[model samples]
Target: MKRRDFLAGTAATGTVLASGLATQASAAEPLKVGFIYLGVPGDGGWTYEHEQARLKMVKHFGNKIETKVIQNVPEGADAERSITQLCLAGCKLIFTTSFGYMDPTINVAKKFPNVKFEMCTGYKDAPNVSNYGGRFYQGRAVIGNIAGHMTKTNKIGYIATFPIPEVVRGINSAFLYARKVNPKAEMKVVWVNTWFDPPKEADAAQALIDSGVDVLMQHTDSTAAMAKAKDAGILAFGQDSDMMQYAPKPRISSIMDNWAPYYIQRAQDVMDGKWTAKDSWLGIDTGIVQVGEISSAVPAAVKADAMALHDRIKAGTEHVFTGPLNKQDGSAWLKAGETASDGALLGMNFYVEGMTGKLPS
Candidate 1:
C-alpha cells in the first residue's frame, strides 16, 4: 500500500499504541484532553467538526482520554484565561481550534511544554506543540467546478470571514475553476469580518442574492447561509459540516473534514510519550479533507465531472493551481499545464485570473 493509504488504514483501525510498557499506563488513567473552541461546538459547522473529533478520540482512548472543551471563548485575553484554566486542571493534551489563538497558543506552549498542545489552522509551532490543516483549496476546486456547470446567471457570491490565508485561498480556488467552465462567471465577495456570526453571514448571502448572483459560497461557519440560500431560492455549498438539511434543494455539495482521526492520533502520541512537533496537511486521499454527500440540487452531468475531478486530484493527476491561470488583474500566474508549486499554494495571496472581486483589505 502507498504511504497515504497506510496512514488512512492505520487511522481507521486506531493503531499506533506506544511501545515499551515501562510507563504502566492504564485505560483508566483519566488522561485529560482539553479543547479551546472559537465557536459553539453545537453550531453544526466548523466547531462541530472539531467536537466530533473530540468525541471520536474519547471513543478510541475510552476512559483514558477524559475530554473537556471550553467553547465560544473570545480571542486575546479571554482566550489566554480559558487555556490557562484547562492546563491548570491537568490536561495532558490540549487542542486549540482556531487561527486567532496563534499568539496565546504559542505563549501557553512555552509555559506548558510538558503538556502537549496542538492548535488547528494555526501556523506557529513549538517543541511540544504542532500544527495540522487540510488542503481545503483542493476541495474548493470541486465547488467551483460544480458552480460553473450549475449557475444560470454566471455570477457567484462569496460570504467571507477575515483576510487570513485560509479564507483567501478558498476564495481564489472557487473563483478560478468557476471561470474555467463558465467564461462569463464573476465572483462577488463580502467579508462579514466575523467567523461564526449567523445573522451577519446570512445577511451577506442575502446581499449577494440581491446583487443577482445565482449562486453563493461561504468561508464563514454557519447553516444560516444555507438557510438563506434556500429562502432566497439560490444555490450554495456547505462548509466543515454537511448542511444539506438547511437548504435541501439549493445546496449542491460541501467540503467536509473528518478531523476525528487526527485528534485521536495526537492525543495517543502524547500519552505514549512519542509525541513529536511535526506539522501535517492531510487531504481526501488520507480521509482528512473530505467532500460532503452531493445533493440532488446539482445536475447529474455536473456530478459526473465533479467526481472525475475529485478522483484525478486523489490520484495526483490534477493540481488545482495549474497555470496559464490569471490573477484577478489578468496577470499570468502559471504557464499552461504548469501546476502551482507547494510554496505558492501555501501562501496564495492573489485571486485567480477571472475573479471579479478584490480580496478584502
Candidate 2:
C-alpha cells in the first residue's frame, strides 16, 4: 500500500525557480507512513473505517506522503513484528489501529525513538507514541435510544467484540440510554473474542434473534449481524460505517467513524514539523464519531428525540455517562447529576447498572 510518488515535472530553464520553492521541493521527500490493521480492509467495519481515513490522508497529501499498510496483523507478538518491520522500512510515522497493539506499539517505539507511533483505541503513550480514538459510546447512546423506542421485544442483543474498556464502554452506553427510554429494556451480550469473524458474528446474531431479540447491536466488524437481523425481521444498527446495502430496514442507523479530519491533521502536523505525542478522544463534537441517519421506520417523534440528543452531544451540552448511573453491582458509580471522568471511562472494567451478565475474564 505504498503511496505513489509525485510526477517529476520539468523546470523552465529560462525561469529561475523561486529559492524557497526549489529548496522546499528538494527538502520535502515523501514521508513514509505505515498503518497496521488487525483485520483486513474489507471487514466493512472498524478496519474499513481506518483504511478509508488512510486513503483520505493519502489523497490529501498526494505525493508528499508515501503510506504503507500491513493488514490482518494479529495483536500481541505479531504486532511487534509488524511495527518493527515498518519502522525498519523507513516509516517515520506509524499507526497501529487496534487495542491489542498497545504494548507492541510502545515496545517498538522504544526501539525506534525517531519513529512516531499512533495507537488507536489503546491507552498507552510515550515520547514517540500517542493514542487516539473515537468516543464510540456517544454514538452507541444514540442507537440505544433508537433501539429502546423501536424494539418490539424489550430484549436487545449486543454482539460484543472483547472485554476491553472500549467495548465495555459501548455496551454500557447503549444499555444506559436504552434503559432510560424503555425501562423494561434488557441487554443480552455474546462475546465472540474476535474483531471481524463473519461466521461467528452471524451465529451470534442468529442466537440473539432466536432468543427473541428484536434489536441488535454489535462491536464486531462485519455486516453478518445486519444480514441476520434483516432475515429475522428485526432491527439492527451499523457498528462502524453504514452497512445498509445488506439490510436496509434492519440497519436503521449507524455510527460513522470519521477519521479523515484527524488523519489529515496528523499528517499535516508531520509535514509542518509539529507532530507530537498526545491522546485524543473525539466524538460528535469533533466529528470523530457521528450518528448515522435514523430510518423512516423509526417513529418521527422518536427520531426527532434521538436527533435532538445527537445535537446536544455535538454541542457539548450533554454527557453519555451522566449522573444517576450505577455499576452492575448496584453500587453508586456516578452520583446524581455527576458525569463520568475520562480516566474512569478509559479504564472501565465493570458493566453499568441495568445491564446483566458477568464480564468474561
Candidate 3:
C-alpha cells in the first residue's frame, strides 16, 4: 500500500469517530422540567397531590428528564421570580400548581417564548402558557351527598379559600347535591381567603361547628379542617388528596385530584415538540377528579346512592349544574332539563337559590 493512501484513510476514520461522539453527546442531554408549588409536599393536601404526580412522572421518564422544584413560592412577585429563575436555569417546561400563580406564569412565559408553562386551576392562557384543573365540582357533589345523608344537624360547613369562581362553583355544587338528597340540608360558608393557612382553616372550622354545622367541606388546601372536625366529633370530606387516615368518622369520603396523567402527558408533549397552549378542565370521566372511598360510617343506602350519583356523572348522564335551578335572588338561572354551559360555569359569580350571605365583591 502507498504511505499517503494509509495516512488519508486514518484521517477519514478519525473524523467519522469524532462526529459519532458529538451526536451521542447531543442525544444524551436530558430535557429539563420545573415545578412551582404553593405549599410544601408535606402539606398533605394540594401540594402533596402535585408532589405525588411529580414523583410518578419522574418514575415514568427515568433519565430522559431532569426536574427542579420550588415549593412554598408565594403567588405574586415571588412566583414570578421563581419561574424566571427556572427559565433562566434552562428549564424547557414548567408547571405552576396553583391558581394564584396564573398571572406570574403568564408574565414569565412572555419573557421566555421558548419555554412552556402550565398553570393549574387557572383560566388564563397564552401561546406558551396552558391552563388545567380538575372539575372538582363533580367530586364535591358526591361529598355533598354523603354530607346530606350523614349530617344529624342538617347543617354543613364549607371552608372556602377564595371568592373566585372556582370556589363558588364548588360551594354551589355541593349545596345543590346536599339539598337534593335532603331538603332541609343547608350550607354555611367561611372564607379563609388563604389557600393553605392551617390556623385560618382551623378557626373557620371551629366557627362553623359553633354554628351547628355537623358536616364540613373545604376548597382550601390543608388538613387542618379535617383535624378540627375530628376533634369536634363531626364529619368532613377530604380535598385534593385522600385523607383516609382520618377516615371512618370525621373523614368520610373525599374528593381526590389526580394530576399524574396530565403532568406526564404534558411533559411528553414538550419532549416531542408538540406542547400547545390549551385549557383543560377534566373530571371523573377522565379520572382527574376521583371520589374517595365512602367509609362504613355512612349508611349502606347512602353509600350506594352516592356511588350511583358518581357513576351517573362519570357516564355524563348527570350534570352537577342542571336545570330547575335559580339564582340567589330567586331569579331563574336554568329551566328544567337544561344544563349550564362551560362559559357560565367558568364565570359563575352569583350563588344559586337557597344560599344565604353575600358573596364578596
- Residue 279 of model 2 has an lDDT of 94
User: Highest TM-score: which candidate?
Assistant: 2
Q: 1 or 2: which has the higher TM-score?
A: 2
Better of 1 and 3 by lDDT: 3
Candidate 1 per-residue C-alpha lDDT over 289-347 given as tens digits, one digit per residue, 9 for 90 to 100? 88776787677888999989888888888887887777778777889899887677767
User: Backbone clashes in each candidate structure, one number apiece?
Assistant: 2, 0, 0
Cα deviation in Å at residue 122, candidate 1? 1.2
Error of 2 at 267 (Å): 1.1
lDDT of 1 at 148: 84
Candidate 3, residues 89-130, lDDT tens digits: the string is 999999999988989898988899999998998887699989
- Tell me the spans in candidate 2 whose CA falls farther than 4 Å from its real position: 1-23
Alpha-carbon lDDT of model 1: 0.81
Against the true structure, what is every candidate's RMSD?
A: 3.2, 5.7, 11.2
TM-score of 3: 0.92
- TM-scores of the candidates are 0.92, 0.93, 0.92
